[model samples]
Target: MKIKQGILFLITKSEVGGAQKYVREQIAICSKEFEVYLSTNEPGWLTEHVAGEIAGQLLDKRIESRTSIGYLTRLAKYIKEHGIGLVVTNSANAGMYGRIAAKMAGAASIYVSHGWSSVYNGGKLAFLLNRIERYLARLGDKVICVSAGDYEVARDKVGIAEDKLVLLKNCIFPVNATAAADRPAANGRLKLLSVARFAHPKRMDLLVAAMKGVTDAELYLVGGGKGEEEIRSYVHAQQLDNVHLLGEIKSFNGFGDYDAFVLISESEGLPMSGLEAMSAGMPLILSNVGGCKEIVVNESLLVNNTVEDIQRAIRALQHNYVQYKMPVKSFFDINFNLLVNQDKYLGLYRSLIK
Candidate 1:
């Protein structure tokens, strides 16, 4: 069967995080089966990273980038020019604009809800964005949630219909699975790695405070964000010698060096870092939020987003470290592989068209 022609519009303000990476990978995979086109802003790290593949597929534009007016104009023009049958938007900014543009252009639209960007936790601006999202959900043909937890929030809290929502688990390539079997023994110092942008919701401060009770073990803070300076200041203020802030290491070439991986986020849909950590054969310690508990299973430790809870989990994991075997990579291969999940998306596309 001849594949459909579609436009994958990514309106991420920044490209240095998991959502951008997810969009990029999805585009790459979907391109194999569809005439996939990408739309994103210029001068973004994501744009720069995606430049090599942008030869014929990418559309570079400096639109309102976030608001509907600027994005709808650019998106409508592109859809008209390319005969795009479907529009898929990732992230909140793109979801808003893409849904509106698809509606205006009379095209089918799928909005992927990565997470609740502006929740009750954020301030006035966040509340406003939340309202915008609720409005956008009503306009979209379908809203894709990366986790069931997120889907529930959208349905119950945001007033999106259950039928309008689709559950699509985040996909990850488990490159580390093969190498994990040959991993070296844990050194005397238990190494805990957290790979996430230093943002407000990530709550790295809680992790740092949790480390106070964890003796001798080292904590590696990977990834950079707006919270870098503040997180650094707090680390300095606390004299956290055991915590090492290693700014965003994109490739996990040396990931095996760490004994285990941990994340202490206030919220998430499904963090790719935790998935990567699991694939790398490292036991996971995650905050009991979002879909993390779903991935971690009994083999991993779940803690509340508090210093004491985090510290207790860390210590408990360290004490029972030897007994914990990394969850088998087969779990990811069977459930979260790109090929497998892509088929689910392809099925959704077919259903929509029919």
Candidate 2:
């Protein structure tokens, strides 16, 4: 197992959300086997939240802090000067810059599609971006998809060739498994937790609306985003006493504070939060969308975006209508383990370099 010492470039728009977290984890792992150099607009809450040692290996390549031609030029210069062998871009904006920059710098470019970006949803701008992405796909040495669904969208909709695509599910260290297992259940009422940014795609509104129907359960909305004020206004206007907006929990171990986990997102790329919840042995109630269906295997309680469906899921979990073994450890072993999947990525990199 001779590890290569080639320079690797990791790019992301911002250190936020699942893509950011996934890139950070991969950077932490890859740094052990390669000289990993990271480039991003700025530090985000998610990047700051990771453990100190994992965060230390990341070398920030300062760009314009905004996704633009100026930033792309800066990234190109950095890649050339550093003799970067491989450029791995996480998410849409970074992918846009990294793909072109890697080509200019004579480095093998790898684009990691974390989810279907807003651009893929449909619009003149979205159409233009999708076209750009399609053209760029051919330039990339490899296009890594975070989920099977995302892979389909990249191939069928984005027009990326099948041979260029690869699936790499999101992975996280089950660091809190033991602590989460030790957490006591709610004595007075069941705690339902949703860990996501307060954004439209997350469909937190549906969960808030559904909570109106559940009198006995308490809902905790974690994470922050543009929709925070709107969510707060709805909570205050509705006067939902059972719902609590606890903001973002800075530590991964902080998840042990809850009983059950739920995510009502409209789309996802094998959400790590859900995996984290499962690792904690918490019963999960996820929206029947994207990789969520692949994760929530207990089909009996799968929820949808509709308020009625979410309400039904909450009620069902409350009444013991669904039962399934907690596959937390197995899930990690199957998907996230470095020994299981890192070698696959290493192989891909080596193949390209050869």
Candidate 3:
């Protein structure tokens, strides 16, 4: 019998965001061919979902600072001791330390940039971050970019070599229990849903601001983060009765009730929530940033995430909703389906070993 090679996945934190979810999906998909292990800064949603299913370790380091010498040393020792053959790092901080540690431990490393936030951030901080990312790219064998937009930015803007970067768009398993709801009557109010961590690049405030002019619809925001208090205060001060903060929901049972799904983020990397909504055949309204355009039903549904554009897109979707909503499942099936692309990942990993 042949021994299965060991694969270790690492991420900066284990929060239930897009990057964390990506790592979780990789663990499930790759476990079929390899011995899967996971390392996160601390145990949270990712750990919770994968608990008892794999060998998980805690790094106990946040994404805040540069690499820690002690953390790197410990990680290298763990990789060497466990016979880990491949180290897959997700997010910026993990990519930095994990790639270096993988090299030190004699493991091939792959860095998955969930989104190149540094390139889009703008100003001196963005310049410094891009330089840092460019320098760090040398430590990894390959960098997986989740969207075409990010891929272009990595190659063109960040000046990473074309051969070293892989353009593998994000994928998700379809939602099974839910399907798109029938459009509400012309006289009824539109029900819109958005699932996002209320933080930077996710302009929930813009969505709420847009809701002020949208008396004909109710917007439900389903997430919690550092930005929650600020958003709550803004909503209360603005007295937007139509907007409701639904917090985090782990199930898709209630998704079928919404007329449409909206994500007016300032930046994104092919959001899992948007794909989940589309898997349920819900129409998705997204901002024109990152990989959002790659999944939208139509260009008309793309917004600048401004209050004006969001309000406009909502009204447009409400006016001709069925036309926009009908093809959601088809779009998701063709582009973002995980079942179809799982082999691509397997092939990539296999090739890396050879």
Steric clashes per prediction: 0, 0, 0
lDDT of 1 by residue, 1-354 (tens): 346556555565545677877777776666656666677766666666555553244345544344446556867777767767777888666777777777777778888877876663546686576677778878878988898888888877676788789999888766544433233244557888888888867988888887777767899888888888888888899888889999877654455677778888878888888777766677788888888777775634888888888887777776776555445455666767775667787778656542
Which segments of model 1 are wrong by more than 4 Å? 1-4, 48-68, 118-134, 176-186, 251-253
Give candidate 1's error at residue 123 in angstroms. Answer: 5.6
After superposition, the stretches of candidate 2 with alpha carbons farther than 4 Å from their true spots are: 1-7, 45-67, 118-120, 177-188, 338-340
| TM-score leader | 3
lDDT of 2 by residue, 1-354 (tens): 324435444555454566676776676666666656667666765445444523122334445344567667777787777656788887666777888888988889888876767444556677777787878889888888877878888878778789998887766766554424332254646678888988867888889989998888889988888998899999999999999998876544556777678898877778888877776667678887777766675765678689898888877777662244355447656866555667777677767752
Mind sharing the TM-score for model 2?
0.87
The residue ranges of model 3 lying beyond 4 angstroms of the native Cα positions read 1-3, 62-65, 185-187, 250-253
Report lDDT (Cα) of residue 71, candidate 2. 67
How big is the RMSD of model 3? Answer: 1.9
TM-score, cand. 3 vs. native: 0.94
| Model 3: ten consecutive residues of lowest lDDT | 56-65
TM per candidate comes to 0.88, 0.87, 0.94
- Candidate 1 Cα lDDT to native: 0.73
Consecutive 10-residue window with the lowest summed lDDT within model 1: 177-186
